[model samples]
Target: MKLKMYFLLLALGALTLAFQSCDDDDNDGISVPAELQNALAEKHGNAQRIEWETKGTYYVADFYEDNYEKEAWFTKDGVWQMTETDIPGLAALPAVVKSAFESGRYASWHVDDIDKLERKDVETVYVIEVEQGKQEMDLYYSESGIFIKEVADTDGGHNSEGYLPSDLSAAVRTFINENYPDARIVEMDVEKEMTEVDIIHENKAKELLFTPDGTWVSTSWDVRTSDLPGAVTAAVQARYPDYVIDDADYVETKENDYYWVEAERGEEEVHVKVTAEGVIL
Candidate 1:
């Protein structure tokens, strides 16, 4: 399996917010659920260009806060799940959190990106990305200063002199150039199912898996609720007006499109299945 590791660059005093996607009107034609709008207004008062979608069972709001980019996740009924804020330095983290983070295996790795992920009942945690040579890892720490787990690990061997192939798709090449400009392909393997390439970025290493047509296929990236289609989000909101969606997963097959949604109201949580036509099955 090819692992993908995405880390934010630590640019000091950079007041501009450079989002992953530049399209501000992406959510214009899509209908925003009233519950979602109210939730955004309540939690993210200053958030701009609030774009939303159903991700898993959460309604995710992707927006800009101050000079930094932020993403907030809420249940369909408007209960908040978590919010992530881009930050700089370990100084912003709690003393215990920083201590636990520094004690991890990748402690000496170069700091690539840092963010604060806050949830209601759970302790606040820091999502940190670090790089060492061509090796990169993402670490998570609790507010009480305990290492939670390593979210992603992209370290691999860098001797690709005999592995890398000359023929690579434009999309694959562009993805690497834009995301990992400082990285290089060190190893390549062609399997019966898909093609995989080992890469090293600033000493950190990771392998990439691509389909026959060069479509990236890997779980290295976490798909947020905001990444779902608008129709799915709208359908979820309409059908479960009384329940708050906690997470949602879209399932596809040759015959049907189905959504598995987890919802909550007060202390009761229920899982519901909905079809593409907005009918709860």
Candidate 2:
């Protein structure tokens, strides 16, 4: 009996020592560091407390608001902190990124998905992943926050342009300034059949048909004398050769097509319309 008791007591002591060693190791090695804690606090100022969880290979830090619900996450190494922003579709963007989408009038825009791509010409250009309704797209930007391009969108689920959050568009003017300088957009009627853009000195008007997903389906152009079927082209060139064509577009009619031209002169602009036939109408 004495020998059995001695053996049991020895085993208990060994178990206790092992548990103590494990506790010490956890406290010393796994405890949050002071510097990293400070950084996490700075990144999530609104966080009142953090609860940690082991999700496979990662540790998820659930930022709790008043200890009620989990809000955001920070990696074990203190990366990918969430901030507040009101971008329309993607709730994951930080407030700064949300501000970018709102400023671009993209809130009302619909998207299916977004993709970030790997293409570049200069440091100024950046890729942004955008999904508006049913269409997914990659929107590019410059270092100065200017819009660069709507690179491409495919039937595949990949529509994102692979730029980081630091790269996003904020306004239509920014998009136009970076991409198209001589082009002036006169109308964008959602109910209308097309979106019209005017190339003033070039005597060209382009109308792009857009899908509900904001995809450009077709692009139709009106040039002064392109041997096209439109009648307005013939009439305007014959009347004003030296005046310089500023803007021109055609409206379809039951009989034929009509072309209208406008030119910017000092302060006023000259407006002319030509009928489908070779008439000075």
Candidate 3:
């Protein structure tokens, strides 16, 4: 969706930590069960990768390759907690993810992102959304690694248009705009069949799915100051429940930024501060 906001002509950046491993660090012991390890390796060994992280007292499983990545979370006691490439909450991960990663179906594919999807009530599902060029392939999976669904251009991928699958995150879009403002976005199309568009300029930057009618969508504008991502949005809303938006503006070439929201309740007046991340009460 195109995010509309006041443009102020300033720059803002939000930093989130990501795991880095230039060389596979197989030196660590398995935090996951031996059975689980064997199962994943046996199936996903082709482009299959395994990484671990700690979220609170639990452990998280991260799978990745050249163009995609997926996350599966678990407790130290071998109980599955939840999974998502974005949205930092412990919720049910779709069975399709576990199955696909467990089946080695994407073992040879290097994915740039593992898009996390969700419903109004259910926990988010993991989808291997690979951006090939002008085309995108949304590869769905089951928790046990079964291929559930694959959607792409119906014209046998002959069109130059591309789609954005449901799994995209605010971070992905914000990052692109903040880092690659010069990238040309030719269109913005989101409808019932799919959310696809054409981007003509990226200086050889790989398209999410370069194929015609690429099934990948592009979020092509700056985000509103009030429409930040999950954690930042939550933090601000919780921290500044009383503040009212006096004025909101985004400096051009960036998402939300340097905006003022004034709050006055029963004679107490104060200005709530919001950084690129969230409200700083």
Candidate 4:
């Protein structure tokens, strides 16, 4: 009995020491090199809440600036490697990359996150995370937006499940900025067939859809009352002086474009449809 108890104690001590060694190895004990820290300070002004960790041969610094999440990587000798800026939606991607991603392989996969990576070599790549159901992947694209290849996903599960290349993302954003300046996009969801961007104005959500090539697909939000063509708003006011314009939307179908307006008076609501020229239909 005494011999068995001694062996058990010896085994436990060995296991504890092994665990401690493993923990230390995982920590790496890497500190930010002075050169890397100075380079980062010069490049990004002041990094807010930055966290540093070693990955492979690179040291990654994750930080935030102006309410945006960004990552910077540096070498052990303090060489600035690359900076990655997380784009909120595909609409913000560069135009060339956007076009290539839409028509390239894995376009069907839903895009989740887009990181615009800039390296000291003056090379640029777009790291795009895409997923469908259970399967997830990361794809790399060239500076002009050509397909590269798949990379192992390092972002665990932070980016939401969706897919879109940056260029196409930018086009979508441009359309919204040009047409609906007041609405701000909040969430972007990509599907196999279409991409949807949700925007908000005055606490109301509006959904906009686009094709993979950045073609405007459809919208679920009423057009801003102020953005309505003067002719349309004028006609509505002339026809129903007491009613207030509550909703407006410019809709396009294969057949023709339609201007839709909804007006309200007390408890009464009215729907008016017209052509772009303000001709009531």
Return the lDDT, model 1, position 17: 42
Q: In candidate 1, which residue ranges exceed 4 Å CA deviation?
A: 1-29, 89-105, 151-281
In candidate 1, residue 8 scores what lDDT? 27
For each candidate, give its TM-score against the true structure: 0.40, 0.25, 0.23, 0.39
Ranking by lDDT: 4, 1, 2, 3
Q: For each candidate, how many residue pairs have backbone atoms clashing (under 3 Å)?
A: 19, 18, 55, 15
Winning model by lDDT: 4
Give candidate 2's whole-model lDDT.
0.46
Model 3 misplaced stretches (Cα beyond 4 Å)? 1-31, 35-47, 86-281
Give candidate 4's whole-model lDDT. 0.71
Candidate 2: where are CA atoms >4 Å away?
1-36, 48-134, 140-145, 151-281
Answer with 1 or 2, whichever has the higher lDDT.
1
lDDT of 1 at 96: 81
Question: Worst 10-residue stretch by lDDT in candidate 1?
Answer: 157-166
Task: Write the number of the candidate with greater TM-score, choosing between 2 and 4.
Answer: 4
Which of the predicted structures, 3 or 4, would earn the higher lDDT when compared with the native? 4
lDDT of 3 by residue, 40-153 (tens): 454346434677666566565567644446555544665543434442221334554544454654444445345454222122334665545565666654334434345563
Error of 1 at 39 (Å): 1.5
- lDDT per residue as tens, model 2, 14-74: 9999999997765443455554566656755666645554444334444544433332334
Best-performing candidate as measured by TM-score: 1
